[model samples]
Target: MSFLRRLTQAFAPPPRAGLDRHLAMAVLLLEIAAADFSRSEEELGLIRKQLLTGLQLDASSAEALLSRALDRSDAAISMHEFVALLNEELDAAGKRELLSWLWQVALADGRLAPHEEGRIRQLADLLFIPHADFVQTRLAAGA
Candidate 1:
């Protein structure tokens, strides 16, 4: 009974108190991963690997989070909710680092589709990241 109660509690959702930054990151990454109009297995692999290594998530946890991210990204009409969540959760430096990661995703296939570039630029601006900084990050990421 105690074990069952603990399991139930563990599965309970977190309170919707404020914007969840992890959810935002997950959504943003999913968008970038799918920016080529079709999601590639290679891109999905990179996303999964990054979430596991960069975010230090276990396999099952990463899979679940990524799945949720994919859903949220699909449902979102604009990037406003994601930007708001990032602003609430991350400082400037953290936001920059996230931009770098997004660029890395853009470069995963050794090419950046125009649509992907456009999406990244829009997201960077929404995150309040300057164009220069965004370009520098992209160049640094070899995008």
Candidate 2:
């Protein structure tokens, strides 16, 4: 191996698939979080708690995952990147479950901003989830 390549590889952090999943979810959440044209600290806190309690993430791990999520949010071009990961990791049923969780985030601020609803619909379509199921999950998730 080349000297710099070997040196960099030696120091590089290990791969973090769990962190990637959480960050992907964060990208989707942040998209919804900003749907109201404002991203509040309250919204961020809710997102973190959802990731931690809802997704069963540990505290430090959740925080680390959130850091990467911030980076991923800045770099994302389309929602597809986030959904693609979920598509790969989750089956249709699991995707449906995630749809509910997504709605929870969208509605957490107490109102579903137009853009937030649109983003959720867009992601549901990309994930190949049916509209009926999407709506059902949304309602169940309190959206």
Candidate 3:
């Protein structure tokens, strides 16, 4: 590479791996919200709110991320790929926090379906969250 190119590359901002992780997290939240085959406006609102608050993203950025997540979630055949990305990107506490967010999403519509609970349990196991922490997060989310 040329000297100027190398210098410019060195000074350039890092790639948006953090944004990718945020997108993965948003996909998980969307999955939980859609699990019951009932996607309420309240649930979507909560998802946007969580994305804004958790990632400290501006409204536009959150919306874009949500848009991407929605597309990715739709194209996905299983949670395995999303869960794998999350496992690679997040630590234990982060995964637990994600579970908490998921519970919040599940209960956002003021009711929890049986399928939603089952989905949460499945995701928790896939994310390697301890059963105790899963229960605690469920209680914390008032689910």
Best by lDDT: 3
Which has the higher lDDT value, candidate number 2 or candidate number 3? 3
Candidate 2 per-residue lDDT, tens place, 25-143, comes to: 77787877877788778788988888898779999988887788877777767666577777778788878877887787777777888888888898889888998999799878776
Residues 10-42, candidate 1: write the lDDT tens digits. Answer: 998544443377778878887887888877777
Candidate lDDT scores, in order, read 0.83, 0.79, 0.90
Error of 3 at 66 (Å): 0.5
What residue pairs clash in candidate 2, if any at all? none
The regions of model 3 sitting more than 4 angstroms off are 1-19
Output the worst ten-in-a-row residue range by lDDT, candidate 3. Answer: 12-21
RMSD from true fold, candidate 2: 5.9
**Candidate 3 local lDDT, residue 64:** 93
TM-score, candidate number 1: 0.82
